[model samples]
Target chain A: MKIRTCKYFAKQSVKSIWRNKVMSLASIGSVMAALLVIGIFLILVLNVDYLAAKLESQVEIKVHLVDGLSDTIIGEIRKEIKGLSGVKDCVFVSKDKALKDFSESLGENSYLLEGLEGDNPLSDSFVVTLEDPRLAPQVTLAIKAMSNIENVVYGKEELEKLLDVTYFLRVGSLVIVAILLLISVFIISNTIKLTVYARRREIGIMKYIGATDWFVRGPFFLEGVLLGLIGSIISIGLLATGYYYIARYVEQQMFGLLVISLMPFQEVLKSLTVSLLAFGVVIGSLGSMISIRKFLKV
Target chain B: MIELVNVSKTFSDGHKALKNINIKIDNGEFVFLVGPSGAGKSTLIKLLLKEIDPDQGNIIINGKDVTKLKRREIPYLRRNIGVVFQDFRLLQEKTVYENVAFAMEVVEASPKEIRRQVPIILSLVGLSKKSNLYPSQLSGGEQQRVSLARAIVNGPSILIADEPTGNLDPDTAWEVMKSLNEINHRGTTVLMATHAKDIVDAMRKRVIAIENGTIARDDKKGGYGI
Candidate 1:
């Protein structure tokens, strides 16, 4: 294709869009709407997965020592827990240190623990962080089987529920995105079919006058791509604005909880914009190709 | 040159549009295809254009078996043949000049060449003055002339006209016929399918009359025979 011919086809595509303004707008609107929903779900799933991962990494199984255990036996227990499979690290918190940390956490109520410091009731334990939080049950069982350990605590029920929610979110988002993509393609293609149907006589005339199938298809294909691009851009714009305001509201409501922070707009925007643009182009072109295939048989 | 040897077309609905049809038209010859309604003339034109494939036998144009041509190769074959339709299928949105230029553009002709050839073709069809007018702004005869200019703009070796003047008044029909005669005289083989008896009888061209999906008569300087 020569540069001149490309320009001609581009001009023709723009003219066609202008000529069929109603259908063009409808296509763009539907595509944008679908993309917006997909974008929202994508952001939601990503943020939920991120927060789940943060909470999972914070999970640590505490192995409590039996009362009156010797210093050497305590050291042996710490070494055993550290060597356990899935254990990323084992930090030994002595009874005195646990008592002091708990007192500090109480802030103004530190005096309540002042008299108990001499007879620290808190147990000296190994705070064992696992490589994967999902292995909490297995790791907890291993620690419990060790000698000189009284009990293990890792918030088992809460961790299981968190993992389940993340799993569901990942699968659910994928299904929703897939269905939305299909709907976008269906809507875009039908809109293009209307355009092709309207100009079927023109296509027949072109066929009779020796226009190649590509020649007949070029303008329509270009038109479809343009529609997709416009739709995606609009959707991205809407998504960005919507995400910014929602993130701001969430931040305001949960100011101290940085662990559940929404993804930074700049980072999400960069990747989201690129993927949406590519999706738009693919859907648009595919729709145009399918709609015009039957007409080009001439 | 075109040759149809034992070509046949039967619709899936069990209607035989053409059967055992044999035709050969040499270079630069003008031929008229005369027939009544449902007499298979349109099917024959379609076969020649390769719009629909033949159920049996081969259609050879310029030494290439058109029936065996690949999907991509059909366009090249069509480029060698220009077609004019009964309704004068002009793009109502385009001006006469753009309509003619579009034919050349489809085949990827250069801008310089299109600018040079479109005007000359429009002049040949005697529509130079109305080159900027849309099809609706022109008379029926003028629209047909614009369609003719578009058809021949690519300098096709064969011009296939299917009822070029079907909707025109007798006087306008003659004007359209005169333009076709001029094109034929300039060495383009012309194959016209028509129901106009007076024009066929007066012109006295070689006539291939079809009836019941078969060639009933093939005559040199033949009149329209009902």
Candidate 2:
């Protein structure tokens, strides 16, 4: 097509959108709403996974040593635990150090432990951190099987539940987002269908006048793309503002008590904008193309 | 030039629209297709336009077999032929000038060519002064003239007008006919289908009368006849 013709078609598309303002707005509104929902779910799932990973990293198996083990045997046991496949680090906590940490945790109640300071009862243990918290059960089992270990604890039940929740969130959000995208496409296409139907006579006249299929379809396709782009940008703006406020609120309320930290808005903003724009454009153009296909047979 | 050799079309519901049709028109010839409402005049025009395929045999236009043309090539073939409908299907929102210019624009005609040719064609159709008027502001006959201008704007060799004056009054119908007559005089082959007996009898052009899916009569300088 000539550059002049392309410009004319683009102008026509913009004119059509302006002419059918009501339908155009409705289409944009639906696209924005759908995208917003998808965006919310996406951020929620991503943040949940981030928190789960942070929590997983903090999960460490504590191997309590049998009382009165020699210093040489304690070193051997630490080496064995560190040699485990998932073990990232194994640091030995001496009985004296363990007692001191317990007294500090008790704060003002340190006086209750004053009589036992010279004769510490706390067991010396190896704090074993793992490369993957999902492997906590296996590592704990390995630690328990070793000689000179009294007990191995790694929050087995809680860690299993956390992993399961993260897996479900990822998969479930994906399915929901896919369905939302499909619905957005349908809404957009149907709205465009009304515009095309309203111009059926015009299209017929064009065809009769020897307008090629592309010549007739080009303007409608452009209209759809523009609608998608506008809708996506607006939705992205709303989502970013909403996410920033929520992240600030969560940080203030949770303070360091909970490990649930949100991903910073700037980190995801670029990719989110790009993907939403792409999705909007694809849905809009595809909708227009599909709805206009039947009418172009002339 | 147009040629139909043993061409036939049967609708899926078992209605035979065209049966064993055979005819040929040399370049620059003006011909009238006269028939009753269901005499298959529309089907024959559609076949020539390649809108619907003939179930059997061949339709050749300008020595190219239309039946063998690919889907992508149909538009190009259509561009070489102009079509005007009974409804004068002008875009209501567009001015008389834009409607005509649109035809040229679709074929990617240069801006300079469109600016130059659209005025010339509108003058030929006697709508020069009304170039800025929308279709709704024009009379039925004037609207048909705009349709004519749009049809011929691309400079197609053949013009197929199906009942171009169907919605116009008698005097207005003649006005539209005069435009077609002028277009023909300029050497574009004109094929018209109509039920307007008076126009047919008055013009006395080459008339091909169809009846019951077959050509009933073909006459040069023929009047309307049952």
Candidate 1 wrong stretches, greater than 4 Å: A52-61, A67-121, A128-147, A153-161, A245-258, A293-297, B12-14
In the range B1-226, model 1's lDDT, one tens digit per residue, is 9999999999999999999999999999999998988989999988888889999999989899999999888888888999998999899989999999988888899999999999999999899999999999999999999999998999999999999889999999999999999999999999999999999999989999999899999998999997
**Candidate 1 local lDDT, A185-231, one digit each (tens):** 77767777777888788788777777777888898899889999999
Q: Where is model 2 more than 4 Å wrong at Cα? A: A1-9, A52-61, A67-122, A128-147, A153-159, A293-298
- TM-score of the B chain in model 1? 0.98
What DockQ class does candidate 2 belong to?
A: medium
Score every model by TM-score: 0.85, 0.86
Scored by lDDT, the top model is 1
Tens digit per residue, CA lDDT, model 2, B16-112: 9999999999888889999999889999999998889999999999989999999878888898899999998888878999988878877888889
Model 2 TM: 0.86
Weakest 10 consecutive residues of candidate 1 chain B by summed lDDT: B70-79
Cα-lDDT of candidate 2: 0.86
Model 1: native contacts recovered, as a fraction: 0.70
